[model samples]
Target: MSGVVVDVRGLAPVQRFINRLANPDLRALADSLGAELESQTRRRIAEEKTAPDGSPWAPWSAVHAATRHAGHSLLQGDGDLLDSVTYQVSGTQIRWGSPLVYAGVMREGASQGQFGTTRRGGPIPWGDIPGREFLGLSAENEDDLVGITEDWLQELMP
Candidate 1:
């Protein structure tokens, strides 16, 4: 008795086409997008004068000026926080964040309270630190990321 044999020879082209969208290929694309986003965010943080909502950050306090000697410098102080900004990509997830402990507090703002003492031995009220959004994903940022991803995915089309 002869057994029937199935032929998959015609599927070679299709297999190759599918391989283009494989995890390794997609991961390469994800890495590229993550790097692009990290660069864009860092650039904005350094140069933007206003938040994504088109509002300025709170004015520097007298203590801040006295401590840094450059109250008008905007985001720059010792430059530690800005320098700590970095990004990482794991699998398909891209994370952009700062290593600084105060990064979140600085971006989200803190409630009014005597959290610390000033150099003049006065209480440091939290009202002096208004919530200023320095790092966030804006609508334009989202559009850019999505558009780039779509363009990258289109490359895998047959």
Candidate 2:
């Protein structure tokens, strides 16, 4: 109710596959990969300054949400490697192709007055990636975060 709305129909196959995977090895592999991706993304986010008020930039929940969303989006894409593999991230909101996109959206939303001041003077710029108006997060940078999620797609797909 307080966050952006995303269409999940775009990721149905992924949701279904994850639901069906009973292999612990595969599950663990997926988890490990997801954690690595999350860690890298968080590091990049942390490199950015917090709001002018010195508060934390973006919430951890939001970052987690964005990562999960990115995984789901990748699952939904057309790639042979990801077709049968189950990859999921816990606790997320949006479902998109990449974390960069979610970060961009969060950055834009915060900039557009969506979060609206949790501390003192109102919401502040908390994300490192500039908004689309400022060139946004580039594909190269996004790849750096997740290492060509498209490649994961190929690996996951048949």
Give the residue spans of candidate 2 off by over 4 A. Answer: 1-24, 48-105, 110-158
Pairs clashing in candidate 1?
A: none
TM-score for candidate 1, residues paired by index? 0.71
Best by lDDT: 1
Task: Give the lDDT of residue 28 in candidate 1.
Answer: 72
Residue lDDT tens for model 1, 1-158: 89998799988877877887564476677788777777665666677756666677776677766666633356667666667777788888877768787787778777555377678766656355666677667788778888888888777776
Query: Which candidate leads the pack in TM-score?
Result: 1
What tens digits encode model 2's per-residue C-alpha lDDT throughout 75-117?
1233322222232555432122243334345345434345554
